[model samples]
Target: MSSPEPRAPRYLVRRWGQLLLGLLLYGIAISLMIRADIGLDPWTVFAQGVARQSGWSIGIVTIVVGAIVLLLWIPLKQRPGIGTVLNVLLVGLALDLGLAFVRTPEELWARILLFAGGLALLALATGLYLGARFGPGPRDGLMTGAHARFGWAIWKVRTGVEVTVLAIGWMLGGTVGVGTVAFALLIGPMVHWTVPRLRVPAAGDPPRPARRRSARAQAAPA
Candidate 1:
């Protein structure tokens, strides 16, 4: 089903606010994970690697990487929305700010708490921004674009990309530990739970009818 159009100005404002807040929280979540000294998600690991190599902050590397990834979308015929641009810009700024204010706790228990909290917050942040329905972030766009262009399975595309980044990041001195495995196993289910509940209802949206799977959809693998 198609999403409702943004006809009301108030809903538009709410969407924008949700998107910005989600992005900001996403950055802070990353900072929490970093301070926890646990393993990071693949993209963040890549950013950490690049930061280590370049002597830049992880946030700076994230921005540069996002911009570069966004460029690839042009060839894939993917259109970027306003949220995409802000994601590339604001997430990095927020990450830096978060790092400045959030310190690493010396206690292992505290560190674990931070990591767990970060993981949960990251899933929620993902739902919030995506629920706003402005657009997918640059990294997500890259995966979807590749799937569109190459007809690759989405899981294959995601796994391949993440594994490659993780390998490179590890080689470049990024941390890899139990948390990476935990993130991989938990995030998909977490996002699944969050996204549907978190989505912003369109202004004047009608109640949706229960959907039955089409033959093609039913035939598809779970």
Candidate 2:
């Protein structure tokens, strides 16, 4: 009889589990922040704006926006991996689920807890998903693709796109404040702290080179 095929390495299984957890946490983080009501992050502000204009739920708008952004990847020849697909579907579902359970708190301290907790969770979520190395999300792809195709600096591309989105979303009445600024300033450090520690090495993967966030402002956390 032919020898049994070698089993897949254990780390692969762990990686998949981590990926799911990360995505779930990401969705929860978004819900917590929105419910916190202190502010909406930039991409989220865009989703809120579009939700207002289209009358769709924020989760639905988020999914639609992700899909549209994914389509843009075609011209750049960027491909979505398993992580990419999951990020699109799961984060929105989690957001809606979180919203269902979490009501807007009446007390200021409660809101503060939600905001601070959400920020930390979002950073951890970023590390889990990106470190899994399945692929970047639709929004991340948009930033990277623009930089590659246009030969613009990563920060310049990321900043221009995000600022424009923020403006449009703000105009549409998306809440903005301390949360927005905090997310903008702190996420890089947060992701920096978390990504390196949790990253799953490839099966037989070589010594890892430094991994950089292709865009300065990812703005893609759940």
**TM-scores for candidates 1 onward, in order:** 0.88, 0.86
Question: Compared to the true structure, candidate 1 yields what TM-score?
Answer: 0.88
> How many times do residue backbones clash in model 1?
0
Model 1, range 150-189, lDDT digits (tens) per residue? 8998889989989999999989988788778888999999
The parts of candidate 1 lying over 4 Å away from their true place are 1-6, 203-222
List, in order, the clash count of every candidate structure.
Answer: 0, 0
What is the Cα root-mean-square deviation between model 2 and the actual structure? 10.0
Q: Write the residue-wise lDDT of candidate 2 on 1-222 in tens digits.
A: 444433466767777878999999999999999999998789999998888888988888888888888999989878888999888988988888888999989999999899999999999998999888888888898888888887888898889889999999999978889889988998899899999888876546456777766674566664
lDDT of 1: 0.90
